[model samples]
Target: MIGLVMAGGKGTRMDAKEEKLLLQYKKPVVIHVIDALKSSNCFSKIMAATSDNSPNTQSLLQNNGIETIKTKGDGYVSDLNAALSYLHELTLVVSGDLPLLDGGIIKDLVASYDGGAWQSFLVTKKFLDDMNMMLEFSVNHDNKECYYTGISIVDPKKISSTNTIKETYRIIDDKRLALNLNTKRDYDLLKGA
Candidate 1:
């Protein structure tokens, strides 16, 4: 599995230098996510897709020997699809903003995946408490039901079918997926709430 981290936004919502991916917890947000993936031994390759054309993000990946993909926010699926283009195997795509996630949870997602039979699979879970409140997503059903954890396990070939990569998720569950840092409020909430 290839670990994909999406941390490229211009930090528009926060309007601060704190791009959600770079936001801090005990450490930078993206680092935590990357470390988790690395620790899982679930992915053979680790990639980060970002809108930042600067060398900062790429440098980080380069130092770690991970692949980097640049994307556009003009469309959700389009950006994701473009990033998926560089990968050819099963992949784990996650947001760079999930600071509190445990590497173990990612392993669980890898273990729970059914491969979608080339269809795609996502980690699914429910919203029941404050921790659940940290996550944001609506549960949906279509011959199935799940509140898509932003974190997903998918066949790159299947996702590559679409030309869009932004907001590519269609269905899933997993509350731990939502604690992304989008604003100072989001960061503060994460630090304490």
Candidate 2:
């Protein structure tokens, strides 16, 4: 399996002078993500999915010896689809802003995944409540409530012409999976943690 870290978004929500991924938190958020992926020891290779608008992010990753693939910079799905097209095998997709992500969480996600399904890591409703994160959409899986954690195990070959996929697997209730830094508020919360 290969690892793909998606970091191409403009991060308008962050309203920062610099890219959100480049903002420091002990280290840049994207670097923390890359370290997590590397420490997991799960993937044969790891690459960043970036875009033209994010030259600094791309350059930073390349300087750190991580390969990067340019994407459309349109939207999450579009960039993800572009990255998928470049990858010909099963790829583990991770959000670049998830600084709290660690190797153990990635290991658990990979180990729990059933090879047949398009697996996504999810945090249980209780986990979100404990973290004081606003509840977004929830799905009833195995009769339990869970939310997307922005991590997925996708098979590039399974992507359809319209950039959609069917069938899903959920790995649930990992608190470490809840720390996704999208806005300044989320970053503040992470800092407080």
Candidate 3:
């Protein structure tokens, strides 16, 4: 499976002068995501999905010898679709802003795929509340609200045949999977940890 990092979002919620992926906690946030993917040893190839909105992010990864692909920067779904179409294989997609995510969690997610076309890693609202993370969005799952961890395994062969795709929503209770760096508050929380 190819490892794809989505790094092209504008990150308007971060309200920072620099791209969110370039912001440093210990090192550039996106690098942490990339390193975690590498440590998982899950992909034959790993690439960052970049865009015009994040030229600096694209340059940093490229300069460091990481593979990158430019997308339309229109929106998450569109950019993701563009990347999946180009990859044309089974892929593990992760948000570049998840600085705290680690390889073990990734490996567990991969192990749980069960041959589904897509498997989304999610966190329950209770987990978000316990972490004091803001609830940006959620969906009803087994009578509980679940938040997307921005991590998933996708089969690119099924990209055009959405109607026939089988999806699994795996709810993880780990804080590492819950901390998505979207806002200043989220960054501050990560820094304080």
Candidate 4:
């Protein structure tokens, strides 16, 4: 299994000059999520996918020994395509700004798979009802158009271009999927706790 990280967003919501993924919260932004994923022990190949806009970001992640896939564009989708184009195997995709995420949550997701195209699986706190908030983004890498998450055990065979990729599809029933630190307010809310 491979782990694909999308780290190319400009993080416009974050008012600070620093990028959201680079922001430090006890540790750096990406590190916390990376560390959690590392702890999951589910992925054999772990790497980050970034673009040219953030040159130092690659070096920073590389310094920690994580392999980097540098590409040529913006948009998480662009970085997603760059990473997925090469990885034929199933991959667990994570965004750069997730810090409060837990690796065990992902492990549980993989375990829940019954071998279908489980584009979404995992333990997400139910805020409203039966609708599960797929928080994590798993790239249906085989096809650039397919993407799903909140923790998922992917069957690459089932991922096809027929599936829709939403830019910011929210789940009112379970808002827990997006614990994104995209703004100073988000950062403060997390750090304050």
Candidate 5:
């Protein structure tokens, strides 16, 4: 298995001068995500997908001895496609702004993967409600409403154009997956938690 952390976003919603992935929590948000992926022991290799706009982010990852893949910074789907094109076999993709992410959640997602689906995500609705995180879209799976946790497993070889290839969902009640740092309000809530 290969792991890729998506850290190329400009984070306009964060309203910060620096990249959101560089924002300090217990540590840099990107570092927290990288640590989680490393601790999960689920990947043979772990790399970060970055873009030209985020030189600092790329430098930080490299300074920490992490490898990075440079993308166009065009958009999430486009960047994802660029990164996917280079990887083969099962690839685990995670958002870099999830400070609350940890090994257990990643482990669970990896273990639940059946290897039959083109793409799979770990999702939750109750956890989002409990954390007061709002998603513009809601998904219904297994008769339950849920939101994506920003963690997914995909067969990179199966990806032709976009990340939205045939997909599957794994509903989980894990609250750790709900704390996505998108805004100042979210950062405040995360700090409080």
Candidate 6:
């Protein structure tokens, strides 16, 4: 298994002068994610997926002794696909903005996987509302509104075969996975905490 941290986004919604992945809470946001992935002890190797949108982030990861793969600064799915092209096995994909994520949460997510082309982790809308977190987007999961946690496990080989793949949705009630810092409000909320 491999771990791939998706850190190439432009983060226009964050409205930050610096790249969002480089923004620090305790340390750089992406570092927290990389640390969690390392702590989980789940992957044989981990790499940060970067792009022209986040050159500083790429350099920082490289300087810190982490492997990195460069994409074309394309959109989310496109950039992920570009990285997946190089990763030929089960890859754990995580967003760089999930600062609160921890090793236990990641281990639990991986343990919950049974089998599928893709397994997405989500949190119910009610969970975020109770946490007073902002909801950027959502989808109908099991007839309930849920927010995608930006954590998933996928086989890169299976992705290119078709646009439609069997997806297994796992709803987790953990705040660590729910706090996606996508906007100024989300950042301020974390800062104020």
TM-score of each: 0.77, 0.92, 0.96, 0.73, 0.92, 0.96
Q: Please tell me which predicted candidate would have the highest lDDT against the true structure.
A: 6
Candidate 3 per-residue C-alpha lDDT over 1-193 given as tens digits, one digit per residue, 9 for 90 to 100: 9999999999999999999999998899999999899899988998989999999999999997789888999988789888887887889999999989888988888888867789888899998898898646688788889999899999887766656667779888888888899999999999987
Task: Kindly list the per-residue Cα lDDT of model 6 for residues 1-193, writing each as its tens digit.
Answer: 8989999999999999999988889899999999999999999999988999998999999998889889998788888888888988999999999999999999998888867889989999989899999666688998989989898899877775537878889999888898888998988887876
lDDT of 5: 0.82
Candidate 4 C-alpha lDDT tens digits along 1-193: 7776677666777877866788887888788878877888988988888777666667788998889888775676656666676767777777777677667765765564455543543232342123322233433332332223333444454556425432222122222334567667667766764
Model 2 ranges with Cα > 4 A deviation? 135-137, 162-164
What are the Cα lDDT values of the candidates?
A: 0.65, 0.84, 0.88, 0.61, 0.82, 0.89
Clashes (backbone N, CA, C under 3 Å), per candidate, total 22, 0, 0, 4, 0, 0
Which residue pairs show backbone clashes in model 5? none
Q: Weakest 10 consecutive residues, lDDT, candidate 4?
A: 166-175
Q: Tens-digit lDDT track for model 1 on 55-77?
A: 46556666777778888754435
Stronger candidate by lDDT (1 vs 3): 3
Indicate the residue-level lDDT of 34 in model 5.
95
Write the candidate numbers in order of decreasing lDDT.
Answer: 6, 3, 2, 5, 1, 4
For every candidate in turn, the CA RMSD to the true structure comes to 4.1, 1.8, 1.3, 6.7, 1.8, 1.1
lDDT of candidate 5 over 1-193, digit per residue (tens): 9889999888888899898999998789999999999999999999989998788999999999888999999977789878888898799888898898899988988898877435446456666677677644567888878777677888877766563577877777665777788888888887897
Question: What's the C-alpha lDDT at position 39 in model 1?
Answer: 86
**Comparing 2 and 3 by TM-score, which wins?**
3
Which is the better candidate, 2 or 6, if ranked by TM-score? 6
